[model samples]
Target: MIARTKIKPVLYHVVAVLLGFVMIYPLLWMIMSSFKPSNEIFANAGTLLPKKFYPSNYTTGFRGFGGISFSTFFKNSFIISGLSTAGSVFSSACIAYGLSRLRFKGRKIWFVMMLLTMMLPFQIIMIPQYIIFNRAGWIGTILPLVVPAYFGGGFFIFLIMQFIYGIPKDLDEAAKIDGCSFYGIFGRVILPLIVPALITSAIFAFMWKWDDFLASLLYLNNPSNYTVSLALKMFSDPSTQSDWGAMFAMATLSILPILLIFIFCQKYLVEGISTEGLKG
Candidate 1:
């Protein structure tokens, strides 16, 4: 029985490692190919190491197109992502707090509507949203992308609601006895306790906005206003030659911020998700 138990765990670990390698192979290949020359990238595709480590891909990619540096794309992504994340986190927290703690008429209806929205795919609302934004003259701007976050994202609100539900009711009662209003209790009692959930929300919000290609493509027509997604596209042209090496190099660089955020906030993310599921 002891031998079987040890062998089972060993087999499980080996299988897990193999799966991990398989999942990460594409990313590893891209990173390795970024160091190869454009012409050599395809030729040496099967190999993990480059024969000649060409550093020009980074420089060439950063040079960008039409007089705009790749830095502009990175900057725009940061601005859109930062504001959107802040708005989503704050609005979601506020809305979730109300939904979880405050008693009001038709609150259940609102909650149901919110969950229903989650089931509704973005494709269903894309055309109407485009027309609305076009009428508002925000089609060529980032406002349409960032402003909606302030309204509270359905998934984020739900996640935060679950987290809020996990908090003890005793804290709210104690705050009430101490003459705390709803806002006061929220700010003083609940806010500090829900840091993990907030960080999880922020991490997800930032990563999603950072990687968003469809919305960026729809709203941002000007090359100067393009985000990283658009800039990456510029590196390839089916009608002509493509800069695959530079594209891979920039793509590698683009993932660093997300990787760093995940590394630092992973602990909170896991705790928040697990606790929310268990307690809620």
Candidate 2:
């Protein structure tokens, strides 16, 4: 058993090292390719490392979109993502608190309905949703992408509800005994205990909004309104040519923020996932 356990750790470390290379290889490729000239991109594709790294591709990528700058796209992405994430996190937390910590009629039915929505694919309602937004004159703008976030999303709701459930009911009851209202308990007691939950929900919400491609493509018609994901589109031109180096550079830039967010919030994410039933 001791030998088996010792070998297990060795095997795990070996597997982890292999997986790390697999995960990081694409990023290293992107960084290297971004430095290569457009011609060298395909020619040196097999090479793991570039002979010389040039910073010009980043400059070219920033200047790629006609008159529209990378900064504009960055700002638009930031606004849309920030608005949607805040709306989703706050509304989801409130819903989760109500569902998990409070007793109410039809609660189970409501939860079932919420879960049912998660099972439904976006494809099912895409066309109808597009039409509705179009008629409301919300399409070709950021509103369509940001507004639905206010209606707590199904996955986020479930995520926060699970965290809220993990919090002891006795804590809430104790707060009540001290003459606290629902809002007071949520604000003073449960809220403090669920920092892990909030961080988890925020991270998920930010990631979802950050990497969102379809919704941005659907609603943002104008080039000026593009997100970082859409920056890759500009790297292609059927009439003239596509710049692979520039495209790869932009892709690398788009990946970094999401990676950093995960790095910062990973601790909270793991903590939030640990299941502990309410004590009441």
Model 2: residues with Cα > 4 Å off, grouped in runs: 1-12, 275-280
Q: Tens digit of lDDT per residue, candidate 2, span 1-280? A: 8999899999999999999999989888888898888888888788977778877888988885779878788888899989999999888888988988767899999999999989998888889999999999998899999899999989888987887777777887899999999999999987787788777878888888888888888888999889988768778788997898888888888888888988988989887766343544
Residue pairs clashing in model 2 are none
- Which candidate has the highest lDDT of all? 1
RMSD of each predicted structure: 1.8, 2.3
State the weakest 10-residue window (summed lDDT) of model 1: 271-280
Whole-model lDDT for model 2 versus the true structure? 0.85
**Candidate 2, residue 190: how far the Cα is off, in Å:** 1.4
Expressed as tens digits, the lDDT of each residue in 1-280 for candidate 1 is 9999999999999999999999999999999999999899998778988998998999999999899999999999999999999999999999999999989999999999999989998889999999999999998899999999999989889988888888888888999999999899999989998888899889999999999998998899999899998799999999999999999999999999999999988999997776553242
The number of the candidate with the highest TM-score is 1
